[model samples]
Target: MRNPLAAGAATGVLVFFVCFYTKLLNPTSLPAEPANQVARSINAEDTGNNRMHANANAHISWQCLSESDLRDSINSTENVIVVMPAKAAGTSLKTFAKSCNPNTTENLQTLLSKNDAFNLLTKSWDMPGVYASHFWVPTALSQLLRSISRHTLVVYIHREETSRFTSAALHVLTQWCAHGPPKAQKNFFDKVENNNHKCHVREKKLVEILKDRPQEMQMGTIELLTCETYSSIEEYAPNMLFVDYKRANVLQNLLAERYCPKMTNHSHHIGKGAEKVFVQLQNGGTEVSLSEWLEKKSSYLEWTLGLNDKASCLVQTRTMEDNLSTCDGSFIHAQAVLNY
Candidate 1:
């Protein structure tokens, strides 16, 4: 069908051009170069401002809680939550936390909202909590009494790309070794097992096993961290600390000291533990450890950050990570609260 709006727009543009040639625009209508430049500048400013507003609006996927309501929750509890990307020591940290998350395996993978989430975390009026990863947390370290999220401390642990992916791969193998394989992977795994023997197969074989939903491999860990920290830092930086996890343990240690002082951290030592997987990939003529599954990490980041094939965007991401540092004192500016 013909588009009347497009036809009308074309006709109007042609008429305007004819008028410019015949009637000649008035100086008021068509200003001088300086005035035109000023007009363009003003229009550009308006367009940019509108774009930012649209971006902010697009980001808020959930109905947000009011600042006052969030603050009331924060004020009621000095809750702590230890969050980390999947396989990034979150399981270990969770063992130490007095969790408020629903007691189910699903809660380990669910992201909750302010209305549904913080109520549980702050439920123990006398006892605060550290709801380990996968629970939606709005807080990052900002000045107390400012933003709802700022009041609560979010301890985000950072790990290298390969280590995180390797750990994920290990978790899958561990589970598969114990339980044959989850239902999702049962088909491929059954066929593969008919041919091969154990989880000591190449990552190509394994990623293929969990091919239906490869994200379950990364486990939403990177996505959760990127969304929370990036959005928070975008809003709270300069006035906030964007400290990488290595710089933690100051606050983590303080929190640890306050709670589990005599604890022995046995799992602090790092190892791939999946030597067969790493050996298979490294020996695959690429000489890179777990290089086959590195593609999973790359593709996952592309999906998460929308940074697919853009070297500049990758550089920008790295620069942001490089900018993190510890801040003992940073004020929370609740002027704007982006979604958690």
Candidate 2:
């Protein structure tokens, strides 16, 4: 009774669509490329020990790269990707990258597909160098490490988790107050109290905003991100270095000696005048020892940062007597402990 040819064609169309949608039609296997191919391709041109190109683009800013630029950079075998996140000595690293023959990008999703990523690393044999922001995106980080030459030196800059959080929170507050009404700005410190219902509501809003990002890009504690990044680098890249944010100056000098020997030293830009403001906010209305203030907010701080209770003891023990120097001192001490 039914038309056999029409029924058969309909079934075929449905099967094809299913295969296409499920990626069953796409090739699942790719020829394994030697990691040395990437290194050889990138190092084909010996730019001398000082890799800084005289005519290297110097229009450095905290801007993401264009899609076209990103494609070109990742595909080009010449660039070394630098993954530094916000409030993690990014400005200093940016300066370092710009000083070298490095292409910088902030777009985290530039290379999303595995095939394209593989081709980008294996195909291109020409490029000066690249320095890009990976932030804390796990998938992108994995793909990036896999695509780069095994010999490519991957760099990561990290800060102490608690100090980083405090700085980041203060930065957010500063930005919010800058654009907010004068009255609201004046009351900003008061609003930070957990007992304030409005503050609690704002915290919820912040969490929701963070939750809206891609799972890999979700806001995480600095410790968690650092651990993940370290693990990934260990698995993928053999040649890599982790820079401490506190000793960024030392790392900057070392990086210059290795990559841009001729480059001049540039001081870190952020957190210059922030220490005073940070002290004020943390102390609230009254003067208190760094240990006392931190101890008072121990529970809230631990919960907010997803830290273990023992972390409070470490924080308290490490707290400096002088409030003025405590913020900076704590950062240095934290890095020393980690690096030790």
Candidate 3:
């Protein structure tokens, strides 16, 4: 029972602590305040530099493409349209447009088209203005390149999926539960004969009914946009200008690179999405600190970042600090990438 190895390990630990204390007790050997500050500063600088290197060197993620060089063309164009996924960075694209040409608000209609709202694109009741919104696939607008004028620039925005999909599932669950469960009723179908002939089919399983719900009701229309067969934009639409979807300010950066470099900071950012219940369960009973969460989920997170970097998305101005991966916002520069 008395293992020398265990005893030796304990003794080594105690001796190491004693030596550490000895060094701490001797003030003369400790670093001076100025030297310590310098060292700390150096360490901070090194950390920042290292992160920059990692971000740049990352094989999956795309680097921030400059926007300052493209301001003129973006403002001059009259029929430019931005087609973004629901949670894509469409907001930033509009903001960038405004910044590019503040006076063009009146004349901007000729230049840009958004698909979302009246107030966002047009000032008056009716005007040929920019349209921006979450237009699900298979819509008439989805065939923009073929239907519309060839001169019209259509920017298709996208984000990394793994995290977005999980968040979307949670969003659906929360929305469904918010309506409260359907009334529980006993089956009277026993009395009815050949009920299947009629349009009204009685149901006992509420949960099963929900499970059978249409894909769009449970998951956003964007799910349909995901192609299992094709990999790149070249396969889908060759004419579309593909931007990296992960830049903090997807639209802003895109515009900045195309229009206004002066304000191109790529400033918007968002936080990671909700952790899956299964993951939490797997780490059950463990302390499961934030650090551990980040460590375990780095690879998944990086996938989004990589997608963000590679796929071109219109970055929006409204910064979503809570969930960055969902939007075209910048992410907090966590110094190192997570291994998992």
TM-score of each: 0.51, 0.46, 0.37
Give the Cα error of residue 328 in candidate 2, in Å: 18
What lDDT tens digits, residue by residue, belong to model 3 across residues 1-340? 8999999999999999998998889867765679789888877754311212222221222222234322333454554555554445545665656666553453222222444333534554433333333435433333344344444445445554444433443343333333432344224111222222211112223223323432323322223232210112222332333343555254555456544567766566556543321112232433332233434554665253342332211121112122333323333211112233
Q: Which 10-residue span in candidate 1 carries the lowest summed lDDT?
A: 325-334
Superposition error at 153 for model 1 (Å) = 2.3
Tell me the whole-model lDDT of each prediction, alpha carbons only: 0.43, 0.43, 0.39
Candidate 2 per-residue lDDT over residues 155-210, each given as its tens digit: 55555555655455545544443444245234433343323212211333333322
Q: Provide the clash count, candidate 1.
A: 3
CA lDDT, candidate 1, residue 122: 49
Runs in model 2 with CA error above 4 Å? 1-79, 102-109, 112-126, 130-134, 181-237, 269-271, 274-300, 304-340
Model 1 residue runs over 4 Å out of place are 1-17, 20-79, 99-111, 129-131, 135-149, 190-197, 200-216, 219-222, 225-231, 234-252, 260-316, 323-340
lDDT, candidate 1, at 214: 47
Q: How many pairs of residues in model 3 come into backbone collision?
A: 40
Cα-lDDT of candidate 2: 0.43
- Candidate 1's displacement at residue 334, Å, is 15
- Model 3, residue 194: displacement in angstroms? 44
- The root-mean-square deviation over C-alpha atoms between each candidate and the true structure, in angstroms, is 12.3, 18.4, 21.0
lDDT of 1 by residue, 1-340 (tens): 9999999999999998987876464645564579789888877754311212222422312122333433343334466555565655565556555332224222422424322544444445444444555333322221111243554554445555445555565565655655666566554332233243343444455455444334335433333333333444445532222224443333344444444555423234355453223324424434334445555565564444332221212332344344332222211122334544
Question: In candidate 2, how many Å is residue 272 off?
Answer: 4.0
